[model samples]
Target: MSPKNLNVVAVAYDRLSFFEFGIAVEVFGLPRPDINPWYRFATCTAESGPVGTLAGISLQIDRGLKTLDRAGTIIIPGWRNIDERPPERLLRALRRAHDRGARVMSLCSGAFVLAAAGLLDGRAATTHWRYAERLQRDYPDTQVDPKVLYIDGGSILTAAGSAAGIDLCLHLVRRDFGAEIANQVARRLVVPPHRDGGQAQFIDRPVTKCEDTRLTSLLQWLQAHLTAEHSVESMAERTSMSSRTFARRFREQTGTTPAKWLTFER
Candidate 1:
């Protein structure tokens, strides 16, 4: 990749999502002297004055939206609010960057920002499951799959939530530098090297207190015996519930079927 294509710029805004922003910094901003020609990262902002975060902290960003002009990859962390539209200038910068062949990525609610800029239209994207429906509703042109961890639409990528952002970052590393280098980065971060973008999001769901307790115990047991061959019948028996009941309860508590959960775990 050209040195210009190694330049990564993350956007900061008022009421920043620190965790999501931190994901970008952790993946790309940190120096990796061992790797030749690693990414060059910087932070930029569309807003003037101090950029405050939800954690009651403020950021001092020296770079402005014009930084996007030189960015090869632009990261937009979770937006402050899904309902509020980003500044028109910021949107235009994104469009210009994309038009000039810059890769753009959004984490969690930041998908709203990309959508607002018309980058997600006619493309498949994802965001946090809680906001998936709203995103789909608000941006009818985009295909929103709430279940996936992320969507890699070539130049435009969107990650589901905070942790999913990490997965996406690792994926970008893998894409740019191959699995070996990405794995080294993941080891430094103490995270898995890869997670399929198609994996289901662990959506939150309400479960009865009793069922929650039982499922929690069962999950622990399954973790300890990951190599064991198991079936729904066996797992249901372990939980002292009928197979049908177990399947329903498992989906209720885990947002996935027992088989899919087991596959993901392994």
Candidate 2:
């Protein structure tokens, strides 16, 4: 659990998922001199042999489930089949790692694997929208949210799908490192640093492609002057727009209300 010697193990299985698994590798496996002492990443499988992927690629996984025991964090990429139950030994290994305080995370349909292991029982979790219903149906004890991008249940984290896996992984970095470090990592990946998992996965009315520099600059100013006493009316006046228009545009650009953004930034 030392940040300098972080150990992260990603579980691969028969018919491996390429996207989520690659996200784990990119986010945790790559060496980051910017953040000295990055995670030591390894891959393991439930059984053995080359794991076949949906993309028709074969992943050679030599490590076994026992690797979970030595990891400070365990990440489960998308499972091959939701209905295919994970081995009892694999489930037990995950449970043991959790009992000892190893962080567990799942991406997309991988939540099914965690659910099958009973780790998600009585906890809020989410999977890809397509599989959310099945997850809830199969695991009555787990609360499945079909909307948000990800769910951070402390030791257990679950993400919606593909891209959201990066969100969850960056969230882990933000928790272990900090916003600046996480932001650096995101920049390396050419993605935004801190997308709130609570943000709706989809939005009504297409988002505007053009950013209002006037409004964005105003927001930056507001952050630097939190103690200067500000209001929407004030911001609107500064941007030379009516309060209603400013508020609406701000939401469109930031994917959040101004009030929420200020509260979190402060």
Candidate 3:
């Protein structure tokens, strides 16, 4: 990657979502001596004075929006509120950065910020399922896909939720470096090296405790045997259920057909 492209900036704000912000820090800010060259991460805030988080913690932000001027990648963590508009200056900075070939990403509700900046216009994006409807309603020009965990729309990316942000970050690592390096970074972070961007954000239905456990076990088994060919009938047999019942249950628990889920895992 070009040295300029290694510059990563994460935006902070009042009532910041700490988990999402930390995800950016974890993925891009942490020093990675193992890798030849790594992203240079920094935080900037649109607001002056100490920014307060929802957890009551106050963060002193030294860098301002100017930091984004040279950033090659900008990460917007979950915004303070989906309804509240971000500062116009911040949005303009994002536009300028993006216009200059920088990648802009949003985690969860932060997609709203990008939407407000007109960056998501006519682009496929996603956010937390809880906020998906509002995003679609408000930004009619953007394609809001609530089912997937993230959308890597070339220069623009959006993650579904806080946890999904990690998946997207690891994906960026894979793109900037390679599978081996990204895998090594994932190992250090103790997370899965890859989760397909198209994977469902969540299961569609609630299951009984026992059923949930069984489903988890089955999914784990499926992941462990991704290379093996297995039919729905075989999977149903393993769970002692009729194929029709198993298929329905599986779909309810995974929000996808068994074949599609298996393909994603592979």
Top lDDT hit: 1
Q: What's the TM-score of every candidate structure?
A: 0.82, 0.76, 0.80
Predicted structure 2, TM vs. truth: 0.76
- Model 2's C-alpha root-mean-square deviation from the true structure amounts to 7.0
Summarize candidate 2's per-residue lDDT along 16-135 as a digit string, tens digits. Answer: 878888899999999887677678899988877788888999888889988888998999988888878888888899999999889899999989889988999999999989899999
* Root mean square deviation (Cα) for candidate 3: 5.3
The per-prediction CA RMSD against the true structure, in angstroms, equals 4.6, 7.0, 5.3
CA deviation > 4 Å runs, candidate 1:
1-4, 203-226, 230-266
Task: Report the lDDT tens digits of candidate 1 across residue range 157-197.
Answer: 99998899999999999988888999999999999889999
Q: How accurate is candidate 3 locally (lDDT)?
A: 0.90
Candidate 3 displacement at residue 110 in angstroms = 0.4
Per-residue lDDT tens digits for candidate 3, residues 62-153, read 99999998898999999988878899999999999999899999999999999999999999999999999999999999999999999999
**Worst 10 contiguous positions by lDDT, candidate 1:** 203-212
The regions of model 3 sitting more than 4 angstroms off are 1-4, 205-266
Query: Highest TM-score, which number?
Result: 1
Task: For candidate 3, give the lDDT of residue 230.
Answer: 93
